[model samples]
Target: MNQNVATSAPFLVFTDLDGSLMEHDSYSMEAAKPALAELARRGVTPIFASSKTAVEIIAVQRASAITAPFICENGAAVYDSSGKILTAFGLPRASWLDAVHQLRERLSLRFTGFSDWPAERIAELTGLSEGDAGRARSREFTEPMIWQDTQANFQLFQSEIQKLSLTTLEGGRFISIQSQFDKGYAMKWWQARHNQPRPFLVALGDGPNDVSLLAAADAAVVIKSGKSDQLDPQGPATVIRTSIPGPAGWNDGIRQILNLLDSQQLLIY
Candidate 1:
């Protein structure tokens, strides 16, 4: 956590990375600078909750010149501003990979995950540079894959993995298999650690994987991503749907929330 921001700050923001804060195809966050700067100015902490790896999140933090805690691997782990693992909700990556291997052999599943491809291949698939792809491949908790099998086979695969105490998250671009946990679980853990009087929780995301996080927040921002499976959080949070997509939507959503908070005089500063 950044020491400049008080632990009892009035607001805490949780945001997903790809397709929410970053562009869906280009992975750029240029349009969100205004909102990000406003949060910084207001001493509000933004916690990144995403399916990205710790190193990938760290790289984003460094580039953005912000230091805050992050939830990675679809809520498998939480890391501090210094990229230190504060807590983990899942088992080791090797264990999940081994289970996947066994399931594939037994069920003849068809999928190519990060472990099955070289950094170059991953770069080709995700449009990431080779260096970024390598960072992404350094997984500690989950296996993100491109599911190439039939729908029936995929259903069977999910059933088989569930038997092993693992589950899948359908991210914007891949299906991630990991230990049974969601972003909401990790967010609650982070909040418990930081609570003084309990900050106003805000969350933003654009995929099914983000549903849990959105539901857990006091305010939910659903960014438009052109996907048919639009997220509809079933929680009691005040929901804000963005008309635009990506960081532009993210920017609008955050500003709108801040405006609401200001009007209510809920903001401390």
Candidate 2:
């Protein structure tokens, strides 16, 4: 480990949690242990880019011993490794919810957002334990809602959000409404702070919410989902989908990407 020795180009790996790195239903990353170990061995950086709130992602970070900065709450914010807040770009939760409340009454939209649900109900809906649900409910920026309405009305609701200069995005379980912030925005901000030469970004996700994050990456891994929709992002990088699902797919995908890089000497110093 000589200080004068050179390394390959900096590579950052950003990933979604629930359905990409962790089991979709079981919420486990135990299957991807080998890939994680290999990436760490090669000095690769993996950051969790997720729709989960800061509190929720922090819990996962602590449990998994991942110290890299993370993108959270549908890219509402990014936090550094030490838990210092890097940015707060999303709309205020209270103000956003207040508007949604008025919109619900005015449009008669049958929407039940996280703000309306108790932690127990949230836990039941998500199959998360009660304690985990509490962390999930501590939303700081985005308001994810379950819209119980027709597709036509849902389209109309999104139109209304656009008119208000707000936004809506679909996730694994809910649709998020908030400011113009997104996963791409968060990634760009975090990348700016790195002083290294332009790094190769490797992002992975399995849901619609991760489209932007995937699109922003130099190489993207779209994990397969049987119960959810596929992610298709418009980008110039190499894109691949795992035939298998969850962390198993995650492991296969990362290893393949590394092999590709090494064969091409793509990131060699």
The 10 consecutive residues of candidate 2 with the worst lDDT sum are: 1-10
> Clashing residue pairs, candidate 2?
none
Q: Quote the lDDT for 251 in model 1.
A: 98
What 10-residue stretch in candidate 1 is worst by lDDT?
1-10
- Candidate 1 regions off by >4 Å? 1-5, 265-269
What is the alpha-carbon lDDT for the whole of candidate 2? 0.82
Error of 1 at 126 (Å): 0.9
TM-score for candidate 2: 0.92
Candidate No. with top lDDT: 1
Report the lDDT of model 1 for residue 247: 97
Clashes by residue pair, model 1: none
Encode model 1's per-residue lDDT on 1-269: one tens digit a residue.
Answer: 24343576787889999999999878898999898888888887688999999999999888777788899999999988778899999988887688689779888878889999999999998999999999999998899999988999988988888888888888888989888888988998888876467767889999989999999987889998866147888873488999999999999999999898879834433
Clashes of 2: 0
lDDT of 2 by residue, 1-111 (tens): 101111353677889999899987788989988998888877765788999998888788788876778889989888877777888888778776787788878999888
